[model samples]
Target: MQETGSADPFSLSGVIPPTITAFDEDEAVDYDRTAAHARYVVDGGAHGVFPLGTNGEFPLLSGEERDGVVEAVVEEIDDVPVIAGVGAPSTHQTVRHAEHAESVGADGIVVVTPYYYPLDHDAALEHYRTVAESVDLPLYVYHIPSKTGNALSLDTLDALADIENLVGVKDSSKDVPWLAQAIDAHPDLTFLAGSDSLLFPGLEIGCSGMVSAVANVFPELVVDLFEAYEEGDEDRARDLQSEVYDVRDAIKYGSYMAGVKSALPHAGFDAGPLRSPLRLMDEEDEEAMVADLEALDLL
Candidate 1:
């Protein structure tokens, strides 16, 4: 594991899959299915398992459900760290989530910027500082402005990297130059590109890993891609990276999150249904995705 210092034991490096949280027909959290999928990814060679991120429908879950999901994941997996998502709209809630994650045995916590209400640089800085102080666990800031509507300037990110116990960030901003800037500025901090489409480009610069939604369908694909890139197999890395984009493109043809949820069952996981307001792919589109998976020999 790569460490920033003696205080940092958990490395947020390698192809970490932000796994899906399964639900039953009633939309309740299905812990067994969720844990099974977590184990599946680990057995498929994921460096770590990230549950309840955007792809896991974190915003859709209640705090209690979040607790249960993290607990299930930790108990079910073997040998890899579990970085649980503790993103909330408020700092207090985020702190609570982080505390609960630690209490339930999560190896680390990922805190996305507070959503809905945009904050100035100072407020955002204080927000992370407060949460970091509340927990002893290693923390990774999740910088995904598209969903959270709060972007972290390079200065803000540098400041966060300086915070005690805040070790790294997963940049979903999809801005390669900006991510490159963060990597260059904080050489001690780990930077993970949050999109599969940018995986090759990010690695070409200095990203240590990825937090990919598409990894839900093929954990091995992302793992292989990361391995190929790390081993200096440029041709294999490029080919695998291209394959990731193909699957990601298929998933995005439908609702971004829903497309992933829909693919789980086809991939042999029991992902019940997409939570409300997130519709499933239409029959035709579903067939197309299945076809895409078939073409990739993923099914």
Candidate 2:
């Protein structure tokens, strides 16, 4: 599972969602079902698939379960790179996960900034530096301020830019100006917008692409936007952006995964319930999402 120094799959740049790991009624990882979903996504048109990410409920899964999910995804996906999400509160444990991912043949490791304890810019930089040095494979710095409370400051990114193993980043902060700043600071580094709706805006600001959650439900829509933008079809791209805005308004808020998972059973996918402590959608919320999807003919 060691990702050698062949080519950096960490050079992420597209609508690649950290996929939702589907489980059966018994709350077990549905490897066959999930792998089929992975194939569905690759065929639907996405640059890659990320397993064991925040959306995949990384914290809820045991290390062995995480490895199983990664292995299943890698097996299903053809050329689509699988960037394994290996973030944790402990740096040592995070590095261990990263090394495990590398050992399991993952294309790259997506390490989110450690949360719980508020670490300053230097400490944040050092945490990433330590993980990057721990493995020879490329690293993708995941910056989600709302979740981690440890934002990747412009100064910190500037410092980490010098690390050879740190190839790119997926910024989920939703701070467009800050994302722009990261692109400005490191013109060579890959800056992927973690927000699906911001793909066009990120691209306009020189961002390579996105690590979107919506792509799990609407891969073709996001991929269409990227294709249109690349083809210089601004009108088509703008229309896709409008679709994202509408979809985000419907399902991106509150228990987003539950909303999406609720929609899945309707879409002919047997997506089971969410794990405990995280409840599934209530009647009212489920109705709203279904209505939205129905309006779009997605359900």
Candidate 3:
């Protein structure tokens, strides 16, 4: 809502990485390395950077830590949009996070739907309306039902599109039909594909951009894919999509959300360890992942 950056915050196109939050061996937030990772992706030709999202381990971080990560990323990357994730189980907490992001100069705020407690359509609409009105920055609804347990129905999206300052939706649902329909229904709202698996299909179906976790490690690969499609080279784009599929499989080894952090070392970045309860890859699994990357000539 606040106009603080040079880049058009609503121009949320191209490849944007949901960057990982770097932690030390002690599992504490490392602000320096966390900012460095944001710089690394932008340097790799990523169009924008999204911190404190799923890959950043937002659920495990304290509100203060989340604010710190946003400040670090906003300071480190001046040219691209930095859309910080500020969603919580409650609207009150989400508004606080959104306010902090705007104050710290984040170009926009991504609010994942309130999780844990199931809500009806009216409750969901009011929740988003409140968050959108609370901030002056562009607000993008993050629809990742698998993790949040609250899926946004098409009818709900229809209502959301009418909210002022509610600019876009990031769909990680992986339900292509649903995503395609949502995009078709709301041409005014920017739609970003939130899964690497749907990057090409998303673009083909009129997605403005992508929020890829794989880009956190191998950004150039994702960037190349996006560029190819934009340049009208369908063959090249499809080829890159195949390559991305391989990369996704290789990096997805071990526990959930662990592959990206574990594979960072191979990409010349150290995102440290996953916070407690989310274990890193074991020796055996890591070696296999390395071999998979090597087989794909990505190592």
Q: Give the TM-score of candidate 3.
A: 0.96
List ranges where model 2 is wrong by over 4 Å: 1-11, 252-256
Per-residue accuracy of model 1 over 1-299 as CA lDDT, tens digit each: 12222334664678888888888898878899999989988888899989989878899888999999999999997599899999999998999899999998999999999999988899999999999999999988899999989999988887777788898888999988898777777768878889888988888887878888888778889999889988889899999989998898777757656688778779877688878877678788888988988898889
RMSD of each: 1.9, 3.9, 3.5
RMSD of candidate 1 to the true fold?
1.9
lDDT of 1: 0.85
Candidate 2 — which pairs collide? Answer: 1-102, 1-103, 1-104, 1-105, 2-102, 2-103
At residue 217, candidate 2 shows an lDDT of 74
lDDT of 3 by residue, 159-179 (tens): 988888888888999999998
TM-score of each: 0.96, 0.92, 0.96
Worst 10 residues of 1 by lDDT: 1-10
lDDT of 2 by residue, 38-140 (tens): 7767777988888877778788888888888888888888687888898899899998898888887888888999988898878887888899998887788
Q: Give the runs in model 3 whose Cα sits over 4 Å from its true position.
A: 1-9
Query: Which parts of model 1 have CA positions greater than 4 angstroms off?
Result: 1-8
Q: Using TM-score, rank the candidates from best to worst.
A: 3, 1, 2
Q: Which ten residues in a row have the lowest lDDT in candidate 2?
A: 1-10
- Whole-model lDDT values for every prediction: 0.85, 0.79, 0.90
